[model samples]
Target: MLKWILFALCIVGIYFFFFKKPKTIHEKKEHKKDSIMLECATCGTYVSSDEAIIQDGKYYCSKECAQC
Candidate 1:
């Protein structure tokens, strides 16, 4: 019984040490920056796109944003 209890405790400890926490503060901040909602230059609305237009070193949500 004691051996089984020790094995269980060791397993729990290993799990907590390895994969328990979600992310560190620095990682969380980096993730938040990556997930920032970009603003549409045309309508001034928030958008979430992987690729933002870069013209004259400015960010635009889409082609419509360039027109505006």
Candidate 2:
């Protein structure tokens, strides 16, 4: 009986620790609204602003893509 109780407690603890329902992906992304997202001018692929190169108020994923 003690072993069964211990096992149940352990299961509940694990469930709370791992599956307590943190923010969903959309919620987390929406939380960072001020952060910039750069879209490829040519191909329209989305990339993070930090990874993009800025020139003339336009964001480029790479110099090669920018040239095309």
Please, what are the lDDT tens digits per residue for candidate 1 over residues 41-64?
Answer: 667767675667766666678877
Q: Give lDDT per model, in order.
A: 0.73, 0.80
Q: Which digits, one per residue and each the tens of the lDDT, describe model 2 over residues 1-68?
A: 99999999999999999887775645544455465787988778887876887777788888887887
The candidate that wins on lDDT is 2
Colliding pairs, model 1:
none
What is the C-alpha local distance difference test score of candidate 2? 0.80
Off by over 4 Å in 2: 1-35
Where does candidate 1 have its weakest 10-residue lDDT segment? 25-34
TM-score per prediction, in order, is 0.36, 0.44
